[model samples]
Target chain A: MTGSVLAGFPATTIRWRDQLDTPAVVVDLDIVERNLRRGAEFAASASVDFRPHIKTHKIPALARAQLELGACGITAQKVSEAEIMADAGLDDILISFNILGRTKLQRLRALAERVRLRTVADNATVIDGLSSAFSGTPDRLGVLVELDGALKRCGVPTVEHAMDHARKVDRAAGLRFDGFMIYPAPDHWQDALTFLAACKDAALQAGLDPRVLSTGGSPDMVKFAPDANVTEYRAGSYIYNDRALVSMGGASVSDCALTVHATVVSTPTPTRAIIDAGSKSLSSDLFGLSGFGMVRNRSDADIFALSEEHGHIEFADGAPAVGDHIAIIPNHACVVSNLTDHVQFVRGDYWVGEQRVEARGTVQ
Target chain B: MTGSVLAGFPATTIRWRDQLDTPAVVVDLDIVERNLRRGAEFAASASVDFRPHIKTHKIPALARAQLELGACGITAQKVSEAEIMADAGLDDILISFNILGRTKLQRLRALAERVRLRTVADNATVIDGLSSAFSGTPDRLGVLVELDGALKRCGVPTVEHAMDHARKVDRAAGLRFDGFMIYPAPDHWQDALTFLAACKDAALQAGLDPRVLSTGGSPDMVKFAPDANVTEYRAGSYIYNDRALVSMGGASVSDCALTVHATVVSTPTPTRAIIDAGSKSLSSDLFGLSGFGMVRNRSDADIFALSEEHGHIEFADGAPAVGDHIAIIPNHACVVSNLTDHVQFVRGDYWVGEQRVEARGTVQ
Candidate 1:
């Protein structure tokens, strides 16, 4: 709000940890490092490639830290994000989402020229678009067939359908047939493993080498290890476990690195108090969860609803007074990271600095 | 997604309207102008001050246009937003929400020095905060006692409680009691009117002058005119009536000036199709609506679900093919504006330019 640019931490000798502007996303750097190491250690123990999805934090420094912690590469959901990461010197990147249209394809081709870029496709339409865009380019685009294991958001419906798309990529002059990409639900890990194995077999029978079987989900990754079917694992929200991760038994609340630091701006009644954080900050991504978000360390209170800039909380007793700060664990942390331009980094109540969400608003 | 900045419309001779990137918020400039003029005229005929909430569009040019078309000033929900408008040379502004904390109070005091600013408070704590922040300043801060008519998100619960806060503002060193502010639901307009009158009477009896009785709601504003109890009206979403407004009979589908222009990326089945517009673009504000969004001109289809970057649509019969553009009327336009950084401005079928959402991410 001040006309002055947000220049990291304030220059005052006083600690600014407790004086952060309300409705700000505060990251616990200690938990973030622990999460990064935990994911990397797990993938190393399983002897599989770890590609941390940068779409979660969207912080270039965090991605570099992940790489330094032994991650093979980073994954992005949009080409604009990959472009930003590439500019940040993250050369090895995989855009996990499908790319369409000439504008996005041109951007994708430019990104492919700068990085070891791999993209996913589930249909021939997208494969053809990629082929047309990268045919004359020097770098052959790595195109993986997206398989619909359980999350029916995007991807081919069946293994045979994925094989069809894989064959199309194999036949395209400018495309290289990467194995497959599947984001499985927690309960569908077995199905994802089975379908991915079938895809690998189908590609081998068609004389195409299936190099990377990329499958990932934060919850499923916690339950199932990377097996022979999956050559690499991709997970984003594990970097900042949220309430959704806790509900899915992926991690405890202690593992949550990201918390929205909000102030109780109004205690309108005996039971109701309003925080400054709202859907615009915490986001409306319920992810099948119940309330808007969970008040950290305040199990007695409920963030029942949210308007654009107000979070309505109801307390059982001892409601927070105005000017009190409350830490809120949002339902989904990835969306929250995308909502803000910068996040305050902290280390055990000590303010470290502010990290720019470099990939925020990179929605293609 | 392109690395190149969105240089307004493309300079090439080729038509760029059909080639626009997917999942872009496109505003019909003609309809925007018409909606602005209509709202201003309605407020004028009703003989009440029109303070359009800038949270809906967040574009400074549109806010300036509203002021030129007889809007008295602008209303913002956050101090950060008011700062942006004030930076754009809007002198008269009302931040219609509670402000707390030294960080925000310092910013508020700085903003008050540059503009004629008014803020709302429902609790004594907030009034005290404002009083302490402005006691020594040359400018007296205008404080409005927010009343809880029906929207219990924030505000004092009773007229007497509001009068108590008004008296506190009157007694404060550098604060002026500026009547009351109430955002009522459509069904509670009568209650809001009655409560405002009671508060006004109570303040007058307490030897305080209630100058501004600001009552606002887009749905209620369409059905009820500002009467003697209310001196001004504030409505934001009326400028770009969304699906929630259409369902409430506030505006017809044709009156919606804002539409998310998205591309059908995939048709995985006979009845199911996927669009590029997802929660990041169209937003997840159902506002009690059934679906995430309504596909314009395709009433038979429903945007039933959304992932982070994909909208799932199921058709009754026909399905859109890949690369087809669909205009989606989001459940709420204000959140969508906050989601995107730029809105494609269009005139009928012709692409005009891009409007920067200057107030986007101003959720301090």
Candidate 2:
């Protein structure tokens, strides 16, 4: 508990194991390593290249650990995140979102020059932006056509649109069409495999070699068939399964590695208790869950709501007393990682150290 | 659009107004000043002291501007945030949240020693912790008893509990019972006023002076009676009115000072378009609103959902084409301000400068 103060506040680095602070993200090192090994083994058994997304942990140490555990590369949703991994000496990265504008393109080119950088595109405009930026570059940027498997957030709608974008990438200068990248919804593995197979056939018809058919979602990663057209699997939450993952049947509650350690600050009524962790710490991402998070070992208590700095917990039986510490598995782990600057690492019953969320707040 | 690269990524500074980047928070400086003036004028006309919460705009420059425009003092919700403001030379800060534990109490004492720091406590344990930390210290910490007006998040439940905490603060060593602070829900102003009057009467009967009666909520601040018992009003979102404020009938859409500028990245279907600003950029704080955010000047579009890095916009009419920039008024602006490291400042139509969210992640 003795550490130097940071900005007139308690140092985030906790030294004592017994005096765990409230509203701190605590990662069980043993569980995290086990989760990483399990994911790598599953991908290996299926003969798929494992590429864990750094967007989940956002910690360079954990990214390096994943690479050492047989991950082929790392996946990032933003170019800024890729740069952070690059600074941490992770050479291979995939920016799995469409990036636009001249300023972003110039930065992407610079990042590509520094690392084995690949990007995803679903339309001609984004492809044009990438192609124009990398037209005269020494290192050709690897491009992956993003196809909408089920989630219609950001991807080409049909196989024809995917092939069209792939063809554009294939014909463009200073760009190498790697393959197709699809993030499918849960239980849509058959549809995703079918789409990938058709996309591979379209690439062959167009005389383009589709080397990487990357597809993944934590819920379906372990369910992928060995003979599927997918060549690489990308999963972020597998390293630290959340309540959302557990609710989706991706992992058992025992497999959840990260927990928001919060102290109950108020017990206003028999059924209601307020925890120190709020939306600022636990995040407001429901991820289709009924509540904000799940209280570990306290199934009777439900974290039903959250304000900016207070989480409301409703108990089925009796509420926790004030000053009682409770561990919460947040609804979405990735958003929680993005919300904090550091996380406490716990080994067994002792807090070993703190990991800096280096890639946090890199929204641009 | 030319700025020095930051960690191999494009700097989040907008050089030209026309070339402003997407997925950025743009603050209308003129509108912000007007909002500040309007709020200060409203509080002044009611003879109530105005204390704007820094949780809305974490930037110290904006906080100083608010102080310059007649804000009595600044309010912070966390000890870490108060420390940041103290570092920026804000002399008076009221941390309007119950702080517990040895580490936080020590930090609170240090902050109080440096500045005129007052904190809220609803229970005796918290007051005891504060008293123990401040015992034998030169500066006594001002303590406010929090009353639960309507929000059951963090406050004393009944009048008896309020008086009990107030008496505890009055008798505690190295503590000054300043007054009462209550965050009343909209339309519950009468109840809060009555509660404050009762507390004031109790304090007088106990031979103690209740000098400050602090009550605030942006939605109901405009409806406070001139002769109300509230001596001061605290508000955060009034400085930069948001969609939630508009929906609550607090401010007009034209009066909103903050807007999230995002680029249309995808138009997968006729009715579906995706913006680059997702939960990471705009945040997922619905604040009782129907959607994630309101697309400014585009009533035809509804930002119904968000992923980690993309916003799903369902359009009633024709959607905006790819690469088009759209302004979004987020449901909760405070959460949006906390998500980003920096925000773009706009004066009229020109890009002026960038303001760093200094207290962005100070959520301890």
Which candidate has the highest lDDT of all? Answer: 1
Per residue, candidate 2 scores C-alpha lDDT tens digits across B142-249 of: 999999877777788777888888889988999999989988876787888888988888888888778889998888767766755788888999989999899888
Candidate 2: tens digits of C-alpha lDDT, residues A1-105: 122111122233444446876679988877887888788789879899999998999988888888877899999998889999999999999999899988789
Candidate 1 local lDDT, A195-304, one digit each (tens)? 99998988899899999998888886766664888899988999999999999999999999999988998887777889899999999888898888889888888888
Interface RMSD of each: 1.2, 1.2
> How well does chain B match by TM-score in each candidate?
0.95, 0.94
TM-score of each: 0.95, 0.95
State the DockQ, from 0 to 1, for candidate 1.
0.65
lDDT of each: 0.86, 0.85
lDDT of 2 at A301: 83
DockQ of each: 0.65, 0.57
In model 2, what lDDT does residue A48 have? 91
